[model samples]
Target: MSEENTPTSKSTDINERHRVRMERKKEIVDDKIQQAQRKAGVIVITTGNGKGKSSSGFGMVIRAMGNDMKVGVVQFIKGAMSTGEEKFLHRFPDEVSIHAMGEGYTWNTQNRERDMEKAEAAWAKSKEYLSDPSIGLVLLDELNIALKYHYLDVHKVIADLQARPPMQHVVITGRGALPELIAVADTVTEMQEVKHAFKSGIGAQAGVEW
Candidate 1:
């Protein structure tokens, strides 16, 4: 067999090329990381028409708790149904304070006034948490939806978020995040749903959709 076609030779060459490429990539990544010297609390917004928005926020809450950081969670537009995250996080009462404040989706509640009231109440609680420097991470889950529906004032929310403690991270998750909020966010992620099991007639199941 030709030397170039030999299996061992080809494998060795490929491995060497991959190693060189990875080394170069690592150097570039390290330089970028080193250049990022400024450290402070970040505002992360997860919004779009897809799954895992709130799940991502909860995951961060768990991470913060694991690091012994105090976290506060205010869930908007999800009180009608009990979720696995709520149940699980509620167990850590000392580390995490969770509030699920929503009568349900707009369709289910069919009362804009009541929805506004709940959203306002939830925001009131969230403001308290935001002002608390002891809380390292504050997750305003589904607050975007409340803003989208005009239940809460986006300007006021932005002002409060901007005025939060310098080292307190905040995460807001929901669909249809406003442009003004996105503009002020430090990190913004938009989830896109290519295909969902619900479309295939598969209902939400425990430990997954909840």
Candidate 2:
């Protein structure tokens, strides 16, 4: 075979082409990173039919805590049962403030008045965190569910969220995030459910669900 068609030569050519491609990709990525220079806290909404809304929100809380930032969390429609995140976060009382105010999910509670009262109470607690400049991240876990059910006024919620300290981040997690909330959110993530273990006759296991 000719030298140009030899295996070593072909390999070198392939590597050269790949290197050029990656270099071009790197430039585009770097430019985008350069454009993202503003350093302000943001409103992040994680909503969908899939799992991980609360899980993802808690992940941010953990990330913030790792950076030595104080975190405050309020869970709506999920206080009826003990969750892994709640148990773990409770250990660090000084760095984290977590409150589970809901008695249970709406369908299980079946009491609109009680659910509404719980939601209002939870929002009141969340506002305390939002107003505090010391709290770097505030996680309003499952707040979207309450907003969807109209347990709390969406406008009032937005106003409180908007009025938070300019450098404090907020995360709202649940399904059916309202359009108004989405409109004001700095980042909106909608998890798409493809396959679920629950659909395959698997019960919720600790550390995976709840």
Candidate 3:
């Protein structure tokens, strides 16, 4: 072949190799995508003494909803009062179902009986959502704290959740997560407090906290 033809042939060979490599990469990606679609969802547990546990769970809810999955969230320690999460997530009322315990935190309530009652009510509602197959993701916000504070029966909660529909996803968040809860969870994340401004006497800013 002539010099010009030789260069053209080499360029064509390179292009062909690049095209084949891209095609193989695409097939690999397609196979992984199919695998993800076929596998069932699993439980997620987020627990720690640091802040934003619920926030992280809710962020996952948003991701699930974006994929057209139905999500339910039950706030045990956080009451019916307003928060930034409620404000934004409220926009997707149909896609998201949120049930807030009427009674707030233990210290906030200062009434053990009332707190227990509210936690029980919230647990009942959470149980109902957990059993529903249509609920692709369930966020049990502050559930660990409820268990730690003896606001709800931990065994009962575990039993009910253990009987949840297959393929359903559950996320429990709060400090002092129980061992049983951790055992059944497929993914557990502990948000350690490495350094936080709260220890420096800094008040929680709006939108960041609450």
Candidate 4:
């Protein structure tokens, strides 16, 4: 080609450099986003004497639901009692699946057999939810205490959860979590009891303690 007809060398070099730099940056950003998505299927377990374990799990459920994700909740000990959160969530029952064991806690029930029965039923429901790939998140509320008290088989629970779909997430909450469960969990949070009005002779308040 004639020198006058050929493209300017300086402009051509600058354009090639800009294209290379943009391609490299795009590749790096794509890789980082893929890594973040791969690590998304995590299990969060919270156990301690303090409150908010179940509350925190339900908060995640609410967030997922808001994002148009399906969520399942199995309350092991808490009965079908009317709590503020439950009452509020009941409005959108289609987005959330709640299976509450009709019986209350062992401390309140005072019946070992009944408590075990309730826990077993709730565990069965949780197992079904864990197996469902459509469920983006499963909240097993008060499951740790059920495991601590030998209400459900911990090994079976772990096996079922580990076998779930790669993108599914799980959250277990309650006091006295087993070490084996913690070892398998991706994130663990311990809420220590620092102070409480209950010890000060104040009764449990609605929408706060319930």
Supply the TM-score for candidate 4: 0.80
lDDT value for model 1: 0.93
Q: Give the TM-score of candidate 2.
A: 0.96
TM-scores for candidates 1 onward, in order: 0.98, 0.96, 0.80, 0.80
List RMSD in Å for every model shown: 0.8, 1.2, 5.9, 10.3
Q: Choose 1 or 3, whichever is better by lDDT.
A: 1
How far residue 90's Cα lies from its native spot in candidate 4, in Å, is: 1.4
Please, what is the whole-model Cα lDDT of each candidate in the order they appear?
0.93, 0.94, 0.86, 0.87
Model 4, 1-210: lDDT tens per residue?
766456797678788999999999999999999887645678999899997888899889888998899988888888657677777777887888888889766788888888888888888898888888899999988899889998888898889889888888899999999998999999999999899889999998897877
Q: After superposition, how far is residue 126 of candidate 1 from its true place, in Å?
A: 0.3
Q: Candidate 2 — which pairs collide? A: none
Deviation of model 1 at 184, angstroms: 0.3
For candidate 3, lDDT tens digit of each residue in 1-210?
A: 676469888899899999999999999999989877656668788888777798899899999998999999999887756888988888988999989887656777688888888888888899889889999999998899899988787788888888999888888899899898888778899998888998899997878886
Clashing pairs in 1: none
Stretches of candidate 3 exceeding 4 Å from the true structure: 1-38
For model 4, the stretches where C-alpha displacement exceeds 4 angstroms are: 1-37
User: Per-residue lDDT tens digits of candidate 1, residues 1-210?
Assistant: 899999999999999999999999999999999999899999999999989899999899989988999999998988778889888888889999878885777789889999999999999999999999999999999999899999999999999998999999999999999999999999999999999999999998999998
- Residue-pair clashes per prediction, in order, are 0, 0, 0, 0
